[model samples]
Target chain A: MKKLYTLIKNDLKLIVRDKTLLSFLLLPPVLIIAFKFLTPILVETAPILEEYRVIIGMFASIQTAIMFGFVTSFLILDEKDENVMNVIRILPISGFYFILYRLLFATVFSSIAAYAMITLSDIAHPGNLEAILLAILYGMTAPTISLAISTYAKNKVEGMAYFKGIDLLLMLPIASFFVGSSLSMVFSILPTYWVFHFYETSYNDAPAFEFFAVGFCFFGILISLLLFQFRKRVFGR
Target chain B: MIHTKDLYFKYPGAAQNTVNGISFDVGAGEIFGLLGPSGSGKSTTQKVLFKLLSGYQGSAQIKGKEITDWGKELYSQIGVGFELPNHYLKLTALENLAFFQSFYDEGLDPMELLKMVGLEKDADKKVGEFSKGMKMRLNFVRSFAHNPEILFLDEPTSGLDPSNSRILKDIILDLKNQGKTILITTHHMEDAEELCDQVAFLSEGEIKKLDSPENLKLEYGKRTLEVRTYGSNEPVIFDLDQLKDDKSFLELVQSGEIKTIHSKEANLNDIFIATTAKK
Candidate 1:
């Protein structure tokens, strides 16, 4: 627990010091604020946002998952680039524990953003436990997928390209919302599809499947990353 | 506490081993230098000993066991101060040390270590703001934070001014006096001379020569004497083949006209060239 705290603290310190990363982290909240007001104006004319206000809030929350994922991957990559990981690997604790802490940072921060967006966007009841919990799950897994993609990124610039290229995958689950249930299976192949599906199905009938789907997506992304590490040497083995 | 026998390491998919069939030992409380130019496997050997590179043939032992056998516990006993001085650029010097200190449960006081390296004043300053020399000094004492019995210092004094180098050397000697074993790998032969109790000259992944600096000088040194007279601007060299019967040499010395007279022996650079053949 102490080691995890120290690692998380260290990561936070690094993120705060890095201007590029700080901006990425701050972007979600700023956009949520901008969208909070602009969204009201847009809903007046656009009939779609009035019915899909929860999705609009989900958009703000989900952007955090994307940003945090980029932050997590590049943070790990930066450690390698600076060769500090070599110093870190020799620490008394297992180096793999640091990866856990990074993932912890990802999920925790994304959850906070989800809750924060839900409250600020005023699209739903902030006290809605199931809705906020679903928001958190959706927020958490997007970065988890991004984190997995970053593991394959050879360097920072490549990590950025990977982040941008895979950014489209996050919208797939949301896009499936308008296209009807026929496209749901295709999007469900992506881990993020479960997250978007949970939000889409949360207000209507059959909330239990959507809830299980989100959990499955979160664990699925993790299990696949575990398999990746097992099959190939990574983190500079 | 370090011993290697027939050590060999080849990177993945490489044609040949970077460190091939080499061996050496560094005893407790001794400074052993691994000397070589780039691509000669000095770094590779250090990496193998430090367990940074594995999958090598032969043996490297730390504290009576194979290097690979020792894990995180091995790190506790063996400290490393790298050449380039990597640190969290955002963290203050104190924060960085304290952060690393959290990784070790044993004896450590980050402030004292910082003060020992004259970095206590800049303890609050971010490492990114530090000069290169300050960074190097901070890195040198970082090894001390873990209270390791053996230290693996890769080019300990790589990019420091003479004064800072002397300061660092003095601190290393202090550690030696306190019974810490240190292994230093450097291309600076003079560093090997001044610091190492024994030095190994490596070339093309093989040990070309291994001896104390003094012994190497004696073995490869020129067996000659030179003297300068008041009239001559240049010294006259004479072989020590029959020094007693050399009439002119004796006359110049006896007449007290010899401006300087000393045996011509090898400095470390001279011996380095003689052994490594200017590779």
Candidate 2:
């Protein structure tokens, strides 16, 4: 536990000191704040269609999760390129703890980022505590999955390319709503589909237990893929 | 403290083995050096001993147990200083040491170690701000922070100036006096001669020669004595075995005309070039 704390503390210190990464993390929150003020004006000037406000809220939360995942990937790639992971591998501490710690941090950061975006955006707030908690849970998987897939990238440049590419695709689910039901089957495979669907359906009203269950089901798949890919790519076993 | 038998290793998908058949032993409380030019399997041998690389064909044991069997617990018993400086750049020197020290259940005082390496004044300085020599000094001292039974140092004095290099060698000797076993890898023959009890000269993944520096010199050096006379600028050379009986040798000694006499024993650098034949 002490070793784990040290790893997290040092990692956070390194992240804070990294100007590029600090900016990467700051961007999502900045976008959320932008939407917070912009949403009222957006709502006032736009058509009677209130659904775009929900899109803005989901955009902020989802983008926060995605950007933060990119942040985590950047640090991981740095550690790998610097051979810090190999240095730590020789320690009495298991290297698994490093990966495990990142996983937990991603979950925690995503939840916090999600809550701030939803509540501060003030447009698509979950009506109840359960839904709020569920929204946070949904927020956890995007970055987790994103960082997992990012393990394939050899360095930060490649990681950025991967992030920008995948993040652009994550927008597919948001656009799928506009394109109507015809494209739902093609977009449904993405984790962000459930991410967008969760907020779109539950903005003002409390979602059913089954709705939360489906979100968890998608999270389970993402978490599985994450573990399997991490084991294959970064672990090289 | 370390034993390897016909060890062989190949990188993934490489055409040939980076570490070919080689074997040697180092006793407890001894400083053993693996000396070679770059890419001569020096670093590979060190890595095998430290358990950083795997998939070897032969056996390697450290402190009497097979390296493969030692697991993570073995790390606490040994410390490694890689040739490359691997500190977290943004962290202060003290912070880097303290953070890594926490990984071990037992530790020496990091500040004391920093002080030993003359880094105490710069403890609060970020590693990124450190000069290469300062970083090298910090790297050398960090391996001792855990007080491990064995130390693996790969080119511990690389990039260090002569004064700092001498200082580091002094501390390394001090660690030896404390009964710590060390495996050092370097192409620096002077360091090997100064510090190593036994050294292996490696060439292209093979052990070309292995012995103490003195013994290797004795075997390869000319068995002659050079006597310099005051009047003549040139020195006269005599076979060592004939020195006592030869009238000229004794006459020069008694005549007080001899400026200097030196046994023609080879230095480590000369022996290294001859043994490895690496330019």
Query: Best by DockQ, which number?
Result: 1
Tens digit per residue, CA lDDT, model 1, B1-279 = 899999988988999888889988889899998887788888888888877777889999998999878877888888888988788888999998889888887757888878776788999999989998999998888877878999989888888898888889888998998999999988788778988899998887889899999998888888899888888999899888879899988887779887778888787888767667654
How would you encode candidate 2's per-residue C-alpha lDDT over B10-84 as one tens digit per residue?
878989998999999988899999998788899988887887777888989987899989888999999999898
* Listed models, DockQ each: 0.67, 0.64
Q: Compared with the true structure, what per-residue lDDT tens digits does model 2 show for residues A100-207?
A: 677777777777777777887786776666446655665666556555645678777887777777777777788877775877757878767776776777765746
iRMS per model, in Å, is 1.3, 1.3
Alpha carbon deviation, residue A55, candidate 2 (Å) = 2.5
Q: Which pairs clash (backbone N, Cα, C closer than 3 Å) in model 1?
A: none
* DockQ, computed on Cα atoms, for candidate 2: 0.64
For model 1, the superposed segments whose C-alpha errors exceed 4 Å read A26-38, A54-58, A115-133, A142-161, A178-189, A207-223, A226-234, B277-279
Interface RMSD of 1: 1.3
**Cα lDDT for residue B247, candidate 2:** 93
Tens digit of lDDT per residue, candidate 1, span A1-237? 788788878888899989988998888788768877888788888877688876676566677557777788778888766667778777777777776667666777777777777676666433476656666675566446545665677788887777777777666677777776676577776666666556656655444565555566565667566536622545446
